[model samples]
Target: MSARRPYTVRFRTPDNNTLENCFYATDAFQARLLAMEFNRYIKDHPNRIDKIFSAAQR
Candidate 1:
């Protein structure tokens, strides 16, 4: 029998220009942890708004 693989989830934006993110988790709890970390990143770096807008203009 083959070994079980860990669970993973990806969050993406509607526009294709921005960088995509992937979250890997061994289980549901880990998945939640990953999501929380991602959220914190967004909150801390609000300047990403400008980057996305500039990319769209190009």
Candidate 2:
């Protein structure tokens, strides 16, 4: 099994501001999913994810 690592998810807000968050997951796909799930619960309604990559790559 692979260990989870931190990934940085860059997303655009409704106001056109680009923001970033760090999520720990087994892979980039999982990190993106987690970001989307998090966006769902925010009062902003929807935030489009711009990119997702390993935090170490930054």
Q: Pick by TM-score: which candidate is best? A: 2
Report the C-alpha lDDT of model 1 over 1-58, residue by residue, as the tens digit: 4332343433334453454334444444454455557766444543342221111123
Steric clash pairs (candidate 2): none
Q: Rate the local accuracy (lDDT) of all candidates.
A: 0.41, 0.78
| Regions more than 4 Å wrong, model 1 | 1-22, 41-58
What is the Cα-based lDDT of residue 6 in candidate 2?
A: 97
| Superposition error at 22 for model 2 (Å) | 1.0
* Residue 55 alpha-carbon offset, candidate 2, angstroms: 1.3
What are the RMSD figures for all models against the true structure? 11.3, 2.8
Say what the RMSD of model 1 is: 11.3
Candidate 1 residue pairs in backbone clash: none
Q: lDDT tens string, model 2, 1-58?
A: 8999999988777688888888899998888777767766332443467788897888
TM-scores of the candidates are: 0.31, 0.78
